[model samples]
Target chain A: MKRILAADIGGTTCKLGVFTPDLELLDKWEIPTDTTDEGSRILEDIHQSFKSKGDDHELNLAGVIGIGLGVPGPVDFNNGILNGAINLNWMEQKPIVSEFESISGIRTIVDNDANVAALGEQFKGAGSGHKDVVMVTLGTGVGGGVVSNSMLIHGHGGAAGEIGHLYVDYNRRFQCNCGKKGCLETVASATGMKNLAVHYYESGMTDTLLKNGIEAGTLSAKSIVEAGEKDDALALKVIDEVAHYIAVALSSLSAVTNPKYFILGGGVSRAGRMLTDRIEAYYRPITFPPAYENTEIVMAELGNDAGIYGAARLVKQFLA
Target chain B: MKRILAADIGGTTCKLGVFTPDLELLDKWEIPTDTTDEGSRILEDIHQSFKSKGDDHELNLAGVIGIGLGVPGPVDFNNGILNGAINLNWMEQKPIVSEFESISGIRTIVDNDANVAALGEQFKGAGSGHKDVVMVTLGTGVGGGVVSNSMLIHGHGGAAGEIGHLYVDYNRRFQCNCGKKGCLETVASATGMKNLAVHYYESGMTDTLLKNGIEAGTLSAKSIVEAGEKDDALALKVIDEVAHYIAVALSSLSAVTNPKYFILGGGVSRAGRMLTDRIEAYYRPITFPPAYENTEIVMAELGNDAGIYGAARLVKQFLA
Candidate 1:
């Protein structure tokens, strides 16, 4: 059985995993990724972890195959570089794959982190049995990855499936982290939810959330969901709108990448049926005729493990 | 260079072409498509065309390699069946590839005509050197196709790349052919232009177009552009707004796909730099940082040839 090392690099943390041929997670570990301090150090840390872990396995495979690293930000996959990470102080283009290969003596592959999560989910989570899928990650921002016909859709610069930027409302523009406004991330994301909560609560409406010491200030989308599940009027208003926004994005996405399964991942997705149920309700009615019945939305199954599994799967396809 | 048969099936016309491996066009023809009377007759007609072409040259290489047909509607690529073609009155699913293959004694392939156009642009048109691209067909209605990493992304059941149905407004909704309202199609499509023009023409805005039979039922997006080029007030207002709306859709697609190039095709795109210049002017300033300098919006070169070229390209990739 070929054992491969999968690494998922993020702005906050780096995940390392060793998986068997059948995708069994044999071992895993996490490391703080302060890409701000020294970006090269993070790459070294990854090498050190690989050396320490692979020695423990002492397992051998054909040429050690390839390592798949899913990084955050716009990446030039052909050049093997992480162009820049806004969260990280990575202004200078860094050659990630070659840097790792110089020390590890193994080939490497890469894609955007959100895309990797989708791949991971397809390989180990809710989309396990599905061949084509679109996964939305609602973390600090809304991210998306698409797999069609058993392959990842990485656009020109490995930034394909960046769903955060899809326009939700062209008429009433809303500012986004990308400096552009009215993007899907401006509404359907955790940050988006919190923003709406503040806007609504500030609009003056008595709700259980405010009475129970819940304020949009110092609150998150997660908190809003929590409040909504407990029947908070304000939270309900915010979430219903968010669900509708997500449905709009979903229908839009379905139009572009007609997939049977729409996988919802990331932190906010933990709300489960709370999000899915609302999304489905809104998604079906507004979607174009044939698309309504042809697509399905489901929560991601792998949880945090998706990144590792997806990284591993990347190796399987590329290394082979 | 191997020779391949390519066909583009549309609502008003069916385009057939014989292409060489270098993606050079050797010969082309056209036929009106209304298969409601007899579906199978279309195949026989195509077969007769092939026979007239006299494929006495090296037509059969290994497998004689399938004909490529681009139909105007949803399609099941894996099964090579036309899921449904609303334009052609193809009510039931038709095995397009098998039908063509059996008649011509060569394997055949099929996909949504828009996707084929995208493939054509990527392979031999304005996006010739590009690997990842999004092609928007701006005719009476808006249609889209996305290609990532050198592969055309056809999502579950070939639902991927339907950008026209994406929602543009959350509050001021405009009904779309897809049953959803505020779709980009409602504002960006040529049909949408008529909607916008009708509103403007009826609102007491006197102009050359209205004076020159625009209100007398001689108005289309084409007439609008011709008038706009001459600085017609109503035409300028309508075309500029359409250009901006199209720009917004481009930004949305860029945010998601991040393709290196956006190939603008179909009838409306013939507006030339008038359309592209307007989009580029507004798109760069309005989109996120990552998109500002990365993607390019160019007119498609394949034009009518995209359908046939794309079909051949699809079959060629599978063979390669």
Candidate 2:
């Protein structure tokens, strides 16, 4: 049975998985990313990990068809280059795919991590049944990927799915890490939820669980979601505000891409129906008629494994 | 010497054109749309126009390979159905392709006018030589079309490329024709420009050409552009404000679809470099880094003929 090697490389961790030709995951694991040398050792670590996994499973290395990698940055997929990956502390471009292929003796493919995750969901997760899917990951920052006609839209510079950077508010004073003001990420990410909580608390808007949590320095996106789940007014308000920003961004995206399904993933999305239900409520009123009626908002199903699955799926597409 | 017949069907007029297989316009003409009977005679008018053109030129009817049409509303391109084209009083779905094919004895294809126009630009106009292009037509209302990887992106319900409907301002109180408030169309269209002029005039801000034009009931998007060309204060303000909204919408779109070029068309685009120059100025600050550097904004080369040319391009694709 032939196998494929898949890797999802993030800023802090590198997730590796082995899958069969049929796409069944044979094994999966993670290792801390060694970013000490401008991420020069990262590819070497991934290669070593692949060899160790093969040894542990007593599998033949020659039986591996290819390796697929998802990197946390804009990827020049056609040229196999990772460009200015900030998280990995690489300020310059790197030949990621070539290095991995040379070390592992197998052909390799690479793409942006968010795009890979979207492909993962499209292939076997929440977006499996839909050919046109837009996946937004609400983690530390909002990340997005679009798959149209079953092909990922990498745009001209591989910067197509930067949904988090969408400017939602013009009057906002808070600056996004990207040096822009009013980015959707400044209001929709987990940190953005906490900012909303702090803004409300500093405005002296009332006594509520969120206010109390903020005063105690215990306010977090999760805590706010829990309080909202229990019907806390302040927490619900924060959730509604966050959901409003996300819904507006999604509505704007729908008008442009008109995807069939919007899959919400990442940490903040774990708030589940509470988040999606509110998003749909705000979305329906703002989206164009036909798109509003045709598109569906759903939650991610693969969780942490999405990147790995997406990476494997990349290999399948490459081989095909 | 084979040719293609093309029609751009709108609410007020029907534009017909004959083109060589290489897409060069051979001849073109227009007729008022007789929409009295649910657009029943629209197709017949197009047929008559094609026959008369053939007669006038003494061309062989057998040399025409196909006919392509661009309609005002949603289209199911696969089955050639135009769904509820409200502008044409087509409240009921109609099988447009078959009707035209049966009457002209030529194969027929149809698509939303915006999508077809984008294809036209992609094939031989401003967007020519680019595989991924986004075209936004700023007329009475804004309309848009997108081409990705050389194919039109007609979302799930053929509703993709509705860029005009993107919600750009949540605080806006003016409603769009689509029943939504804060849509880009509410601020970026020709009507939207007038509204902005009126907004500043009514706010009691200052003395400017726009104020005088409004007092004389001569205020128009064209007049405002003309004033801005001479550096009129209020007129430039209106132009800047409209450019701001369009830039924001384009930035958001770039984050999602990341097309290589944005082609601005329709009547208002005749404002020429006055409009595009400002749009690019405002676009740079808000767009994601790589996308901002890569995507270019330019005027449509085909002008009013874009729709007819686009319609003809559709036939070329079909025959290919």
Each model's TM-score for chain A is 0.91, 0.92
Clashes of 2: 0
Worst 10 residues of 1 chain B by lDDT: B55-64
- Which run of 10 residues does model 2 chain B get worst, by summed lDDT? B52-61
Residue-level lDDT of model 1, residues A1-320, one tens digit each, is 46788888877889998877666788888988867565657777887777766666765435366788888777777788888766567777778788878867778887778878898888678887778888998877898888877788776766567787776655434578777777778877888887777767667865556444434256767778888889888888878887888888777777777777888877887878877888889887767666556777888887777888898898888775
lDDT of 2 by residue, A10-45 (tens): 889999999988888889999999888787788889
Backbone Cα, N, C clashes tallied per candidate: 10, 0
How many pairs in model 1 have backbone atoms within 3 A of each other, for residues 3 or more apart or on separate chains, i.e. clashes? 10
TM-scores of all predicted structures: 0.91, 0.89
Model 2's interface RMSD: 1.2
The local lDDT score (0 to 100) that residue A294 gets in candidate 2 is: 78
Residue-level lDDT tens digits of model 1 in B1-320:
36777888877778988777655677888977657674546777776766676555445534345578898878888888887777777778888877777777777888988889899889888888888899998887888799887788887767678878766655434678777787778878888877777777777787565455654776778878888888888888877887887887777677667788988887888888887898888787766667546788888886688888898898788743
Question: Which candidate wins on DockQ?
Answer: 2
